[model samples]
Target: MTAAEHLLAAKSFAELRGSYSGALFIIASGPSTKAFPLQRYADYPMLALNGSICCLAEAGIAPLFYLCDDSSFVRNRLPLLLQALAHAQHLALSPRVVGSLLAQEPQALDGRSAYRFERVNRLPEGGEAMSDRRFARQARKDPDFECDFSWFRQKPNRIGFSRNLDKGYFSSRTIPYAGIQLAYHLGFSRVFLVGVDLDSSLGRFYEQGEQAVKSRLDGDYEDYILPCFRLMAERVINPGFQVYNLSANSRLPAEVVPKIDLDQLDALLAAS
Candidate 1:
């Protein structure tokens, strides 16, 4: 029930990478996400990250790809995800969401549709874990600190952490760099980012018609949503792989990705 407990359960990625191969895009639910024709890319080995499942459904997009874990804001959107899951081959979600999902819908996962559940251990301080003492201590001394998490507790069904991930950066806990971490762990040589526009100029990232609940964490966690991507670029970019931002409007760090116009994505895919 603790945020750390949920996040730790979400850390695994090996099982998710087992079958899929090819470029996997980490899709977010930013407004720009609606500008692109996502349905066309359904067959292009995609991965919908968190709240993206809703935007994809709105765009009439089907998930040949799976969904990656991100936040509890999206985690609460489980019913919509269940509907989206029927269209995807696999579903990799944060352990918090997974626990909630299992509790809410005993039979939410249907193995018949080529779908298997992959668990994600959330980066502490990124989810509802901000209430955690460890995270609180870090933020207390560092005024500019961002990211939120809950208390830590051992949990089952979490993705095991790798040595590279356990570096004592801020604290014993971690943050929301999962989009990049999970993407790389999935063996994506090239990444196409959609809707990952973390800036508010694009629009509220978590829109469930419940603006009040979203507003509470949005202000404090801005550091987690966008900065983590920059952090991810520093940590995950490698010789064999690179990331590109494919949004109509984006403000990701230059190191994160080379921004691409939607038209370019369409034309490039059409040509291919």
Candidate 2:
């Protein structure tokens, strides 16, 4: 069966809609996230994306949800991903990723953790799917070209061709954007982002001393990363829901989303 078919047969996310009306912390793997006080927000619901799991584990912080969409991560770093899986209560992945793991090593999904599988559409209607390098060039010239996120406001279980360009819940260029959609699906009223520095030069905190993965930070940020934030500002943030950038040095503009320091976290939570 296709990933879309699997999503159709799986349990609906409606049961978790608005389940967590409190604050949510989304941990990105950016180097700035290393400064975040994990223990301070230990009780808060947290979602860790990709390599951020390494730092979270080192800090003895276990995220509630672990999210990833790239199949290459599974193909190249299966052991690390599995290690992170042990620390998360739930796992969210794309249907393509699920299929890849099941086909390569089905034991990876032997009911060790709860799963939320989403259909990922990299290409939207009326657009040609281009390479990353080419897409970035186009995005740099066209500010209007952005991934659509309207599907997130609808019921979660309804399955169809939910393009990332049309539905924010579907996979985008970055996993953190998908994490935001998951947080909203679970009914979080406020979302906080940490370690989303979007700086390629600084690299990832977990890979500071070790061999670092090659990154297209400059292009990807200008093209895909920044647009995701802009989309959130326009579509997701409202009286019903708000997203805050907690990384003080994050590249995201304050106009897109308010940036707050860790010291203000207590006050923010209290006000919430």
Which model scores highest in lDDT? 2
lDDT of 1 at 87: 59
For 1-272, candidate 1 gives per-residue lDDT tens digits of 33334444443433455344456667766777766677767667666655566766676666555554434644556656676666555565545555566566655653423222222222445445433455444543442232333356421112122212221122112222344454555666667777756555435454635452333234534434444454445544666666778864565555456787767666545643
Steric overlap count per candidate: 13, 4
lDDT of 2 by residue, 1-272 (tens): 44444444445455565667889999998877878888878888899888788777877878888887787778866766877767887777666677776766656655555455543324423456554444434443433233332223321211111212223253446677777777777778889999888788888787744567766778767555676677668855788788888877888899987899876777889988
Question: lDDT scores for all predictions?
Answer: 0.51, 0.68
TM-score of every candidate: 0.61, 0.76
Candidate 2 lDDT at 219 equals 71
Q: Least lDDT summed over 10 consecutive residues: which range in candidate 1?
A: 154-163
RMSD of each: 8.8, 7.7
Pairs that collide in candidate 2 are 18-187, 148-165, 148-166, 149-168
